[model samples]
Target: MTRLRIVLADDHPLVLMGMRDLLEKDFSFEVTATLDSPTALVEHLRRHPAHVIITDYSMPGDETYGDGIRLVKYLRRHFPVPRVVVLTMVSNPMIISALYDAGVSAVVLKRHNLNEISAALHTLQAGRRYYPPGFQRDGAIDARNKFIGERINSLSPKEYEVLRHFVRGESMMQVAESLKRSIKTVSGQKISAMRKLNVQTDQELVAFCVTSGIFP
Candidate 1:
């Protein structure tokens, strides 16, 4: 059996060390290189390509390859052969969707049991796509709607409260009064919620809430 060669990239040093230990100690996988930034990882890849690349979705880079979708796109385009596995704290559906479209072999959420990484690797070795557990379950009727629901779920409790009031036809000031929060606080929460859901306008945000069943 040919041993799997792996390359790793993450911004945090501790995370990089921990991942290397896990892969080498128990899995007996050969970790060719461990890097602290996407830029360094890309450089290492150019020098030494591996059978698989496990990377954090967000990593510090100078400008072009700084983070998220851009780095993922670069790896898929440049190397193309080494299967890509994203280990990330980001659960944003839109970003995850972009990674999938960019041809990532698997996505393992950092919050999930590390065992999920094992599962993702197994599936990838078999030539199948692996998502965070339960992402594809329940036979979701519409992918977009499902993603919207997930984005909503990612919001903070206060953010969700502000958004709920706005969806009920309340103005930002009105929501502030009802929630006993200052207008500025309510507005901030609303803005944060909108950013998380990737909506630019109040109308669009409320429409998303209604469509996703968060507002009825």
Candidate 2:
């Protein structure tokens, strides 16, 4: 059997290390690298592309940046053969939908039953898409609705627009330019949106949206 070469990336040290150990212990996989940042991981992909990329959806310090969605999009856009699987604790529809659209092979929540992730990897190896064993069972229709509803109930249109750009790791100036609105307009929208979203800081807003799956 040709061993499937892989790389694991997550901002959390323990989580990153644990995932590497788990994959090595439980499967016929060869992990080529484990990285703490997406920037370094991207550079690694440039040098030595792996068969798969197991990435967390969120990064602690990076908040909106150095995250899995953008990283996966970048990998799919530029690299060869490395399929991405999101292995994180976030269980939100916006998150699910965003990662799904980002071209990941799988998006497995960090359920206590992480064995599903192992299964997802094997399924990917066989040229198939994998969702967690009970993603549907676990997150019933109501739970999914709750996430979407939260976004709907919390943010206004302009705030939502700011969030769309913000979640994808865009700068405030970039958001202003892209929306063709003034920085003051963008700044006001952001502040209002943050209040509605119930977040005090921009970093928290990004994390909330990512966790909620509202931001790309």
Candidate 3:
């Protein structure tokens, strides 16, 4: 029997090492590459084919393939063959939903038992989607989170980009410059995003972004 080829990526060295060791102990898995950044993962995937990829949801350093949904989308767009499983600590239902929409095969919360990783892989092999325990419970999603998630998904791409930049600590002027839009235009986009998110102040916006794990 052929061992499953896998690539593991995480910004934290310890987490990356532990995951590699844990998966390698299982006779069925062969970890082909362990990468620390989105760039390295993409570079490695370009030259080598893997059966599966397990990567962190938030790896903050790479500017080209920013983390979270964007990174997931990039991976799906460039390498559609490999099954992508995201490892994240985020519990936000909205963000998790977005990840699925971005084409992730599964999401394994960091706080869950490491064994879930193996289970996720097996579930995928069986031609089914894997969700963490309680993912389907009605009580798992609150009214407020559902509302916020719906509203968040409604933001236009430009508005979403403005809010993302703001959450990353960029000033309106800087965001405007980076996006090549005028300050007034950028400010309008920010306000529109805030309204859509139901945030009344910049602090509130930042707090929502942090708590919701949307910009992570």
Candidate 1 lDDT by residue in tens digits, 1-216? 466799988888898888877777645378889888878888999899798899986554335464555567789899998999999875545556667888898899888887777678777777688988766456444887667667776786567656756776778787676666799999998888889899999778877777666642
Judged by lDDT relative to the true structure, which candidate is superior, 2 or 3?
3
TM-score quality measure for candidate 2: 0.68
Q: Write down the TM-score of every candidate.
A: 0.64, 0.68, 0.77
Better of 1 and 2 by lDDT: 1
- Judge candidate 2 against the unseen true structure and give its global Cα lDDT, from 0 to 1: 0.72
Best-performing candidate as measured by lDDT: 3
Model 1 pairs whose backbones collide: none
Please, what are the lDDT tens digits per residue for candidate 2 over residues 49-165? 688888887653443334545556677888747788888765555556667777888988776576776888889878899876555443445876765557545555455656677
Indicate the residue-level lDDT of 152 in model 2.
Answer: 48
**How does residue 63 of candidate 1 score in lDDT?**
51
What digit string (tens of lDDT, one per residue) describes model 3 on residues 1-216? 557899999999999889988888889889999999999999999999999999997776576676667778889999999989999876656667777888999999988999999899888878888998767454556898877767777776667767877787888997776566799999999999888888899999999888886764
Candidate 1: C-alpha lDDT: 0.76
Pairs that collide, model 3: none
